[model samples]
Target: MHLVDIHDEFTHFMANMTCLSVMSVRYSSRCILAKKLRDCDRYTNIINYFELMYCDLKVRNESKEIGVLCLFVLIYFLFFCVVFICINEYYLPALKIAAIRLKLNEYLAGVLLVGVANSTSDFMLNFSAVRSGSPTMNLAMSNALTSICVMGGTIYVIMPFKINSASVFRDFLFVIFLLQLIRFFIQTDSPTYWVKGLIILLIYPIYLAVNIIDFLLMRYNIRKLRREIEILRYKRSSPMLDKKLYDKVTTLKDLEVDDDFKILRMKTRYGIFRAGVFVTPKPLVEPRKVDVESNRVLFHNKNNPKNRFLFTEFIQDLNPIDPEHWMFSGKYGRAALICVSPAMFLLRLAIPMVNYEQIKHGWSKLLNCIQIITNPFLVAILLETAYFTTHNNSWLINIYFDKALWSLAVTVPLSLIVFVDTRTDIPPPYHKLFSIFTIVTVVTLIWICSWEMEVIISIIGSVFNQSSNYMTVTFNAFSNAVPDMIAYIQLSKNGYGKMAFGGIVGGIVFDITINLGAQFARSNSESRHLLGDFGETIYIFLLLTVFSTSWMCLVLDFNARRSGGIFLWCLYVMFFIYVTLIEANVIHDFTADTVIEVKD
Candidate 1:
């Protein structure tokens, strides 16, 4: 070979190596950066999400009542649609994806994440109500039932889903008893309601305990069944075995194993434990070989035709950097994106997402610099979380659980950011150590979104002059239930009806217990009437619904058939309409005790 040719080939090899090195760095940087957040499509196309909702606005100086019909319901509903999509599509799904990474069962994931995380927003409203010395438990309790009806009830209409009869039955019984107890408390108007609430709150841990026990017993029964099968196999094969014994073994082999635990034997696996069965990830932590993607929910829907609508598909899959789904793909989309780029950039800065985002090396570097300089609040939050969750045994990691170590926290993350190379595409965001904070990061986003929801509700209520009860029952119920319904809809869509339904019930139980308890504990209302004039109508209707649900479950022998689901869903809609009419004064407000006497 010629010397010139050999030298040229060597040069070419070195160039290839350099390019590969650059690519490798970019990939790792993106992954570590992902630990910074759980990103969603909402981060992109910010204008598309917010634009149409405001296009109908007309500034009016008068005609508030007329405005209520056009502006309040229609415009506010658009706003609701946007927020609902955000929560159902991104926030809750992100939490579920995290659970999947941890390899937890779907039912358990729903109960734990959906049950507790929802309180982020609810507590804010409850806190506001308590600060005003208002009775807050009514809203929380009613919202629980509404959430179940909206989520669990709707699942039946979609498909005939058999529930884990024992677990669901236990949950329903707890809710039934608890609901009745709440009714009594409302009737009495006890000042020691806080104590009662505290007592209820304490039951949550016990509920969790029961759930864990039930899960263990379930595992044990699976083992027991397998053992019986093994014994039967041994008896069938044994030459010395008696004919009668072999015949009995053959008969026992016909025993069934149900995944949903529908049969009486399966349902009664841990009968004693059954009595107590009422209850109830980063972006991801995966092997180095597997690509770590946080938008598992988005990708999973790609192939499912049912999950897609041809019109909204683009919005659903929007990833700004990904050319395939980029808004810049079309002329109008490009123009719109450019127009809203500034707003979108600010929103991105406020809520950064990391995992699997194809952020360019150059832009990633620039963004790091820009965000650190412009958004010091983000820095402060990152620093604060790092300080507390340091995972180090050092005393410097404060035990006080307060911001006293703010200075230290600031210094540590700031110094670490430099070494973490948050500036460059390859070197920055290589902070794999910070991956643990992804939960905190996603949670912060959920919390911010939730707080924003409270603001939205407050704004709408102030405009309409709706009574607090009406606001809590209708707006609060719809807001809380919508996200939950969307979540359970996903579960049921995937044929995890049992898991979906279990989660709905468990979530309601959580709301009624932990959430309701908090409300009661915080409440200082002097009002003798907890139920406003017709508030008892909702409670009464909910009780009847619960009784009907119980009867439906029994008739089907715990099978959640479509017939039962549609019936319950229809019932819920009727209930919602009835309540709405009462609020509108179209129906009789039967209780004279409806209005709480207020101190001026």
Candidate 2:
């Protein structure tokens, strides 16, 4: 009994010892795992601390980075200005020449080339934005609005003089009305989408007509007012009135009276006259009434026939002495005639007493010369010649005390020759080379400009409340519109009236539709779609801006004219003011908060 009990106790003790060893192993492993987890957590905290410090350093340096970026952008903008001015000076004439060579019809060419040329910078910017997969549709739309509202408004505020006529408001109002229609078209899926485009296309011409009519009316009113004022002034200054008044004063003095009575009479007369000195009656000029007989021109030589081919007659008909004819038409005509005149002179030289074989040889040389001279350099030379012929009649310099003028006279032409690649002696082959160089330089400038804009845009997006949607409304819109407005001024001055109108209204139309047309078409093809929250806001703001701008352009009779410029500008200012207030939470656009649910 003692031996069995001892064995049982030994077995129980062995089991207990094994259990203790297992528990110790488990405890040690658990402790090691816990220690590793604690170390991992510590490393994570250290990494987080470093990350925070890095972020703080970046925040501290952000102002400097922005400052540097702003400096670069400013330099780029200056370059952009330089390039734009050069393009304006050189590119326009070059383009006109190019168009002439292409044989584009005058009116069509004006509408397409002149109008489109002005907005090339904007087109390039938008093209780049699209290629980079940014929201270009919104960018383009915003740019248009900014141009119309902000730029238009600024011009008005700066110059708030009264307009003689208010016809421009008609076109402006029409555009605003059209914009509302466009908004509806954009928002709803109607069968009339294509119809809307057609309407937009047609509406621009009507807008142009309205502007032209208004301009003419303004000119008419100004002339009428001037004539009225002139008539009033003439009446006031007429010798007849002075003579009558002089007679009246003399008669009053000559009247018979005793000394005391005369004195009293003079005093009474003087009192009556004293009132006239302080407040005279307004001149009552008889209004010129129209008579049928008076209006008719009674020709002294109605049946006389004039010689058509006499040099004097031709000169008179051509109006060669007229400054306008000489400066514009004559200059262009002379340049064009140079090309033909050379060949004609060459032919005449050979034509006199020449054998057939010799004539053939002469003709071949003439053809070669013609080909050689038909280069862009020739155009440049022609321009220089025209400039010299008209402008050089009077010297820019004087012999005495005019060193600055002398230097200007000397250096300006030289600079033009070098920078513009204009030459009289440059040969045909070299002309082509110069043309290529010019073209390349222009393209390079444009490329650099676009790149700078993109970079600046990116910087702007990062630094401020850089939402693409809002930025489109503010900066992008303003930037794009500048080119169009500038182009309009240039083209209009050149008498390309249709072209100028097309560039502005056409740009707005194209930006609103075509830029996003592809996207919308594709999306609609796939399924029904709506813009996200940001896009919707942009569209709404755009609509509101257009409506306000249009309203500003309207007169009491709802006509458009330059007078609306001030009001248009005010609308733009109000828009920005409201936006600022809303942003600062002094106000809010509650529409932004409302969401409409659509059921599929």
Candidate 3:
């Protein structure tokens, strides 16, 4: 029975083994088939290698691009920051330092340094206008107005914040404010020359005195430091002199034995010491010699006798022959002129959205017949109506009438001359007369218009003790309207393409003037209420405006004729409006808060 059971177990084991082997073989075959299918359907090795290479290349390219872009951005940012810092801090401060060192008064230094810097912009604008054949009156008016706007606007914006007074009145009462007021009064016609001279001259002396005081203080501090050093030296002693006799004797020559020489020993309660005395040979000393002939002998190098003469000749040659060269070569003078003149031209040309390129294109051609007959006259009429409605003073009225007559006279002659000149290739004998008439007319018109605007605004403020916001808005609108009219006139006179840019200047002027004016007016009352605490926000804007205006003026003056009267008048109107807004706000605040209740 046991043999039968063992045989059955062995048979069962053999059967199970056979089944397992067959299953294993089938599984192996399926694995091989699957591998073959994958190989046939896709090029896995090639695809994987290509993908890896592509990824590597992509990463490399991406990193390089990013690095280059980052580097460029960093460089540009640093360049701009450096330029700004140098101009605002280093260059400006250096001038101030030089002025102080020279013992110039603060005002004089300011006039000489800052004024020249500032006026460069004006000069450039004026010069450009003259070059472009713009009427002198217009150029003058524009410069004056731009100056007033920059100064008054800056004060109006900054004073309120600094003083923490919401009232424009209190802000206006500051020293600068008072000075400006005084200046305004003094600017009247027929002012004594001595008064003007005194005012102008005193500025420099004040600047000089302050700087001198600073120099003295600095010198005192330096002397104090020297004294401290001397005191420190007195507290210490030299160790080299404290050595024993034996230690001090470095060589056998330092000691000598003579018949009377002796060694001595001494004993004390705390110590005993033995000493040897030695005398050395006499010290070697050189005899002093005085040469009487040395002083009389002119030491000249035989090989280089021509050196001195050559140097002298070089210096003489280098000396500037012309005064202009000397002035232009100076760092301050050149910097002031270069920086300021371009700035002024830029300022004049900068309207909102308008740049130098656009301005250049607009004024290239002279005004045409249609422009002369329609657009400018219409603009003049509208401007006059706006002025009359807001300000009704006799002086202003007369000025307005004068402006009208001048415009009409100038426009007609200019139109006729241009038409005749263009039609006939050669000017007639009376062309000179026509040209004179046109020039006179334009100049007179611009001057009258500017004077009228100023006088009218002043009269309105004086009588009403308020600014005409409505008129200010109208003036801004008119600025835009005039440009549109000019564009249309240009189209009529010289076709669309010729005067393509004529409209651009007007558009920019309108937007900037109106928006800026509105902002000033709105801020005037509020800013005054919070005086003596405003941050750099207001001043920064002022500075930017000044810079831009200066640049514009310079560029424009170089490129085109500009009407100073018109520019100045526009600026005057804006200033008047700003002042009024500030004053009114102050008055209102004062009256509203007449009584205050305190609670503990």
Q: How many residue pairs clash in each candidate?
A: 6, 11, 66
Candidate 1's residue-wise lDDT over 1-600, tens digit each? Answer: 699999999766643331112112332242222222212111111111111122123223335324534543454444444444445433543554455555545556656666665554455434332113224456655676576666666777554555555677677778878777766766665649787777778877877787767766665665675676566565545555555455555544432322222101011112212323221100112112212333223233334543233234323223333355353368776665565455344434433233332222112333333333334455355445433333122212222324434545464566555534432324233432222233343344444344335434643564456655666676666765665676676555544566677677767777778656775676653434344444566667777777788878888887676567667777778877887788788987546543778999
Q: Which candidate number would show the highest lDDT if scored against the true structure?
A: 1
Which consecutive 10 residues in model 2 have the weakest lDDT in total? 257-266
Please, what are the lDDT tens digits per residue for candidate 2 over residues 1-600? 999999999767643331112112332242233222222121211011111212222223446546655665665566456455445433444444444444443333433455445444454444442223345444655566666665444333322222212223443455456556555656666754455456555655665455455444544554554555445555666688666556544433322110001000011111212334223212133222223222122221334432222344223323313344346656677664453444334322212111111112111222222223233233343223322222111211112222223444544454344434321221222232232333333443444345445445544554554554445555545554554555454443333333344345445544444444434443442212223223444556666766665455444333233445455566566666665565556776534575799999
lDDT of 1: 0.50
Off by over 4 Å in 3: 1-193, 236-600
- Model 2: number of backbone collisions: 11
Point to the candidate with the largest TM-score.
1
Candidate 1 pairs with clashing backbones? 34-354, 34-355, 421-428, 422-428, 532-594, 533-594
Which consecutive 10 residues in model 3 have the weakest lDDT in total?
257-266
